[model samples]
Target chain A: MTLDALIQRLRDFADARDWNPDHTPKNLVMALAGETGELTALFQWLTPDQSRQAMGDPHLRERVLDEIADVLLYLTRLADVLGVDLLAAANAKIDRNELRFPARQA
Target chain B: MTLDALIQRLRDFADARDWNPDHTPKNLVMALAGETGELTALFQWLTPDQSRQAMGDPHLRERVLDEIADVLLYLTRLADVLGVDLLAAANAKIDRNELRFPARQA
Candidate 1:
């Protein structure tokens, strides 16, 4: 699905649960941090191969994806709430980086 | 120090170690995934407060920060190697998201 559609689904999910209030930019940042911790749970002790294979397991993969989606949704909302253009920010930072790490010498 | 300086340091670090060759975009992306796993290790089962406190511990925090730095450094190098502007990409993505989720009705 398109990123737009994915965001809408998250909005619908949050609305159904009345969790939007807790999704203020600041709160969402905190929640992202928390959920990131949860996502990390899946690979606590596994080797790299195990971690990638875990992603192949439907049950485990779904849970991990959900956690990641949770964080991404909150981030999207947070950016939306603050009137920040994530893509713009990313692009601008990237431009600056180009000058810092020029290609000719790299 | 400036972000540029930080990146220069990373370049120096990689060059001294002769790991620049392994920092191709693809490899850096993989390395990032790996370091992310390590960063996540510090707070596998900790409560939110505990996780925050863990960041305050010098040794543990250092390791976690190192892991995070490793990911960021690789990301920077990867972007450098690919000639991709991270900030530009971020900004561009953010702009697209703005149109996808407008604020007035949100």
Candidate 2:
């Protein structure tokens, strides 16, 4: 599904729960930060090799994927609240990054 | 720009820096986790209200947006290495979340 479609689903989900009042851009940003923390927590204390191999453990992988999903969902919602087009922003970021870290120069 | 386009740019960036060998899935995941931590650190002492108003402080907001971009770029790279379609996975996750947090019950 497209990012817009997912955003709409999130909107519907929030509307259904009367969560709109709480889903402001700021709140969503905060929530996104919290979720990011959770995602990071899963890999805490792991060596780089262990972190890379984390997904090899089925149970651990499931937990990690869930955290990843949470972070993305919150990000999508935050973008929606702020009227930011996540895809567009991401694309623009890449363009800037290309200039900053040019392949030929880097 | 599409997510695919951004992913391609990231791949190209890595190639330019000869960073491909260091960008393995495990390394990407670890990097992602680290970036998430940086994102979370920005909100560490803020109350909910402060967090929501974080972006009002121009410098803080810029920092926050940069962290957000960092988290996303790493995630996109990790998905590329793992052969995961981030959009598909996000959609699937919303489906599951709907079941788990049904509007009617939530």
- Highest DockQ among the candidates is held by which one? 2
Listed models, DockQ each:
0.06, 0.38
Docking quality of model 2: it rates as acceptable
Write one digit per residue (lDDT tens) for candidate 2, span A1-106: 6667778988888989888888765567567767766766777777766766777888877777777777788888876765556676666666778778767642
lDDT of 1 by residue, B33-63 (tens): 5655564565566664455356456786555
Q: What is the lDDT of candidate 1?
A: 0.53
Q: Which DockQ value does candidate 2 get? A: 0.38
Cα lDDT tens digits for candidate 1, A1-106: 3444545655665575566666554355455456555756655666644554565577875565455444445545544544444444434444555566565433
Q: How would you class the docking of model 1?
A: incorrect
* Per-residue lDDT of candidate 2, residues B1-106 (tens digit): 6677778878878888888778766677667767766867877788756766777788986776776777789888877765667777787788898778778743
TM-score of each: 0.46, 0.78
